[model samples]
Target: MKLITKFVLLYLVVTIIVLGIGGFVSYHIIKGELDNELKWRFLDRVERVTYLLEQGKNFESPVQDNDDTNLKIVALPNRVEPNVEIRDTLVWHDRLQQMEHNLKLVAHRNVDGTSYRITTYGALVESDDITEAVIQILLWILGLQVIGAVGVGFIVSNRLFKPFRKTLERIKNFRLQDKNPITAEETSVAEFDDLNKFVEQMTSKAITDYKNLKEFAENASHELQTPLSIIKGKLELLTETDLSPEQYQLVEDSQRSVKKLSRLSESLALLTKIENHEFTGTEEVNLSELIKDSIQSFDEFITLNGLTVEADVEDDVFVHMHPVLADILWTNLFQNAIKHNVEEGNIDISLNSQRLRISNTGNPLSSTPEELFRRFKKDNVNSKSIGLGLAIIKRIADQYHYTISYTCEDGWHTVTINLQN
Candidate 1:
């Protein structure tokens, strides 16, 4: 749940608890006051009736009273003891001719040598009226509380979270390599301001480190090229000189070693450039055409190995990528398939709307195809292969946010690259 929603729900729960307690206390207070008033009215009526009897009023005619209250006088054999008694009980009211639950108060007194008792009854308090009044009042208070709480909560939440939302947007759009990177935005909230300052410092440091590393790779690649060329030339000249068989073999081996070293250096430089995103210019390229051209370029190598090729490339499978990088990616994948395959093996290349797959029949691998993507990883120790081909393919695919996967079973290695439209 959102923070604002949780806050509102918490506020509502507290309000309900307080209102419940308030309602309980108020109902009892009002009921108590009403009970006391009813008792006092009963007692007052009894006193007035006794006074009228003492005044020697004649009792020849029937007396009438309000339906809710009654007064009666009775005579006894002797003077009655003077006392007051009250009880809640059922009494038959003569005027209404029905039984009623009332507060009955009786007073006994003597006047003119006659014993007489005066009784007064008041109707029971209406419980439903009291409940209805309390409910109405509580409901009004509850309704007002809900409206005010929601309004105030919305205003406070919006103000409180504004800085956080702005910070999130800045982070989302921040780019490390951009000339103008994101900076910490000033905020009234101290914690939010501190967070922004920390993020800005971290991103700046990371960009500075990346630039230093990229510059070093470029300088190192340039510095090594001339030395490697000189060494290869000297080794080639030595191979042509008159010498013993052992010396000639050593010179030939040295030449081959120099060539391998040069290729390894070039591969490392290319990998670094790809990582640094140096190939940023992009254009629309027909991927099917590119694949066919790559396969044709390798026709001599494929013929030398006696490999059978099966290509099922669809028409107009287009992609957006740097022209040079696109060619390098396809070249690496095709070379990897041919370089690792067995003599007289078969290569199957399939392409459609979703993905590209290159499956080649090769000697069963002791290790899985996943290890082929690591630098200097070679399945055959005797083969003069610089093992950075798969690694380069992976880097290029990653740059495009494409998915590349490898699966090998039964001497058939399948490399898949999911193409994006």
Candidate 2:
């Protein structure tokens, strides 16, 4: 069950149990009190009748004189006779006939010929009526109380959870590279307020760690690049020193290894920077113009590689994104196409509102499209390009909340970037 339902069910169960116990106790107590009062009234009437008989008064006259609505009188003749046993005669007068009473009577002859017996009973008029009224009143009150409790519960629960809902929404919408921390005001409930504080702390810590890591990687890559360049230059100069063929081959191999290392380090540094959200200068950029520029820049490379370039882009397609990052994205994609394409292959670039797609005819990737975005994932065997190119584009798209996808058909590979609103 949902949280609210569980809460409401538990609350109602407790309330009902308490109310049931209270109502049961109250009903019995009130009934007992009413019964006691009826018994006392009956006993008091018995005493009055006995007193009147002791005074040698006529029972009928006393019954007539006593106007008690719940009282009655009776007289019975002596049963014993001088010769043999004789039957007794009994007479009774219900003075208050209209008054409803549950009566109990006992008769016994006195020593004298005149005899009387007292009777006791309760007035039935008030007990049932009063009990019904009490029950009705209690039920009405309980109904109102239950309604109020549910209403109050809903209001209180919603208010208490309001901060949690807001915190969840903030986290969902949060951008790691945006560098904006959660700074909402505290909630009324202490637990929720504390939770919000904890989330803020976590986000802040994550952002700090990301920045530090990216900075370390970028600095290390820069430092390595300088030494690798120096080594490559020195190796070129060493070719003038008259080395053996074997030595020359060793030098060339070492130079190639250094060049590969340099390229790998550069790609790693770029990937880290992109993931860290270092590209921040953004404006409304014309994507159509960017695509045209990319094609122009890669024109000579395309021709030299015997690749046909096709651009089917709409004009003035604008989007809000970092211009430098966008340029890098297009450049890497275009380069990947040229590098991986077969001789005399075709490259098609298309753009429309909020979408840019690049497809190139090349060898089918060995890996699935889903794995293509992962670091160090290379599809072409002879390609010197590090696998971080697509990964960098993916990170850029993620930082900007854009959507990117890859598709492969026959020998053609397609990459699409969907710009976010």
Backbone clash pairs for candidate 1 read none
List the candidate 1 regions with Cα displacement exceeding 4 Å: 1-160, 369-387
**Candidate 1: worst-modelled 10 consecutive residues by lDDT:** 59-68
The C-alpha lDDT values of all candidates are 0.82, 0.74
Clashes of each: 0, 0
Q: lDDT, candidate 2, residue 343?
A: 93
lDDT for each residue of candidate 2 in 243-273, tens digit (9 for 90 to 100): 9999999999898888889888988877777
Each candidate: RMSD to true structure? 6.8, 9.0
RMSD of candidate 1 to true structure, Å: 6.8
- What TM-score, to 2 decimals, does candidate 1 have? 0.69
Give the Å shift of residue 230 in candidate 1.
2.6
Highest TM-score, which number? Answer: 1
Tens-digit per-residue lDDT, 102-154, candidate 1: 66677887877787777766655555567778889989998998998888778
